[model samples]
Target chain A: MTTDDQIIRNIISGEQHAFRVLVNEYEDLVFTMCYRILAHRHLAEEAAQDVFVKVYRKLHLFDQRSSLKTWIYRIAYRTAIDHQRKKRVRTIELEKAPMVADSQDDAQVLMERSDEQQRIRRGLAQLKTIDATLINLYYMEGQSMEEISEITKLSKSNVKVRLHRARHKLAEILSRKQMEAT
Target chain B: MKNWESDIWRYLASELMGTELESFEQALKDDPILADKYESAQRLKRNLKDFPRLSPNEGFANRVMQKLPAGLNRNLWVQKLNRKPAWYFLGGAVLLVVVTLSIGWPQGSAASSDMDWTQIWQWSTQLPLSFVCLISAVFVLLLIDRVVTR
Candidate 1:
């Protein structure tokens, strides 16, 4: 296993193989991040690929001031967010046309939960983007609050507050659904 | 429920830790309403924990690798060397030496006596004038050839 520093040096030295090694190591992490953020397979894959290309072109600009993983993840997060923004704009443009004949079916399909498990996923989806991101990073990825704060550029206390609110929102959504079902 | 209900729930979810955890436990113990909120929070956390992960399908790695940019197989040293400005400077230096030696050799052998210090200095002074005249002559000849061909 090549150390992160060694991989960086190899990349700087123009070793194509070294770039491959670096990509192989971080591909899953980057892809997972994009997947979580985008929630669409094709878009997530494209975003992940774009992130690697950006990393390759901008590697020389990397100052080694932070860990390579953190830098890469930061890039991945930004890229995913940018893609999501663009996608939202496109969706808004399409919203003018009564494009949906039966939007109710989609909501019904989403509501069919075998257990409370689906409620959590639904709640997660409904939470604010930053809140959902915090939960994913903190719970799903098992990142420390400090790491989450660093990634999101939020203060530690702010991250705590957000995480607290995010979980509460999710719980409230779940409970509401349960009550409606009864 | 109190606003702290979420914090209490997060603590039960194992998402909040350390001082936050102790504080939340104390809050839950003190307020019955807070404890009831904590129970719902625990259920939600448990459901989330049990939620199935949507892993990327098989061949996902292959798909990603296939989409990667090309030109990754090129030789590193060659690529680096091609990008270095020093190589162009070195080439220019070699060309200068070759041209100087080629021009100087015939002149040196033809006028061995004129190659002496005083004569060499005189020749060096006239060299720029000779170069200008030679360039003009080449241009004139090319012009004449074009006119004749027309």
Candidate 2:
């Protein structure tokens, strides 16, 4: 398989076909990162598309100082954050509406595992955006601290400390849920 | 010893393994509190790892592809070169060459005499203004191109 760097070089050199390979390789990771941050599939999809478009436009500015995946994920992270900010502004203009109450029967139909998973998702949502992102990048995405530092532009030490704190916070959230269940 | 609870927990998470592992394990064997914290840390690590992965929808790629601009298929060099500034430069250069040739090429009998000393002096004096105008026009065109493209 062609490396991502090779594909990017080819794309920059005018082979449009090479971009398709990059899109295929990174779409899932980008989509997942956006989804984790935005928590809405449609918004995540839009963010992902925006990220790739920015990537294509700005590829010339890419200096090869970092890996292609790191650069792309950095773009994805920034795009998702920007989308969220815009969404927040728009949401503020609308009148607050009461959240729809799920029917008891519908709630009961969800499996315990599914419910637990939802609780974890909710706990993740409770985290500050950076903390949540650090957890997602470190755990779900299986990125190293150095890679996370590059993507987030944090120092390696900061990445380590923040990740440790975020994990503890997540564990506390999960433990509280476990207690509530019992 | 300084409190290595955090370090022990970090090691268990595999974030602090390798070189630090043996020293931490040695510390753990001697300190009961450290061992207890290590156990809790291990549980937390397992719990975090066990969270279900979220997979993208099957049409996710198709949806993203649909949102991209159609012209993105063009080659990168072609795309970059096709920007307004490049075209402006090319057009300006062509116009400069056309204007220079037009002015220098005199009709019939005048063509030879155009190079004569007196005529050459006249042309030399007029050339600076024309050159300046051409340069100014090119500059203005470039500025206009940048604003419009933006």
Each candidate structure's TM-score, on Cα atoms with residue i matched to residue i, is 0.56, 0.61
Q: lDDT tens digits, residues A1-182, model 1?
A: 43987887787676667877877788877877776677665687778888887777566556677678878878888898899898862322211323232342233223324346455555666776688788877776667777787788899999988987887677666667777988
Q: Once model 2 is optimally superposed onto the true structure by TM-score, how far is the C-alpha of residue A158 displaced, in angstroms?
A: 2.3
Per-prediction DockQ comes to: 0.09, 0.16
| lDDT of each residue in A12-81, candidate 2, tens digit only | 7767667777787888778778877876666877888898887877776677788888899899999999
Q: Please write out the lDDT profile of model 1 over residues B1-150, one tens digit for every residue.
A: 345545465564433222366666777678677677667667665555443334344455555556555554332332343323444544555565556545654363657665667655664665665566555555655563343222
Worst 10 residues of 2 chain A by lDDT: A89-98
Query: In candidate 2, which residue pairs clash?
Result: A14-B75, A14-B76
A149 in model 2: Cα distance from truth in Å? Answer: 1.7
lDDT scores in order = 0.64, 0.67
Off by over 4 Å in 1: A89-114, B1-7, B10-40, B46-150
Question: Using lDDT as the measure, which candidate wins?
Answer: 2
Candidate 2 global Cα RMSD: 9.1
Question: How much is the TM-score of the A chain of model 2?
Answer: 0.83
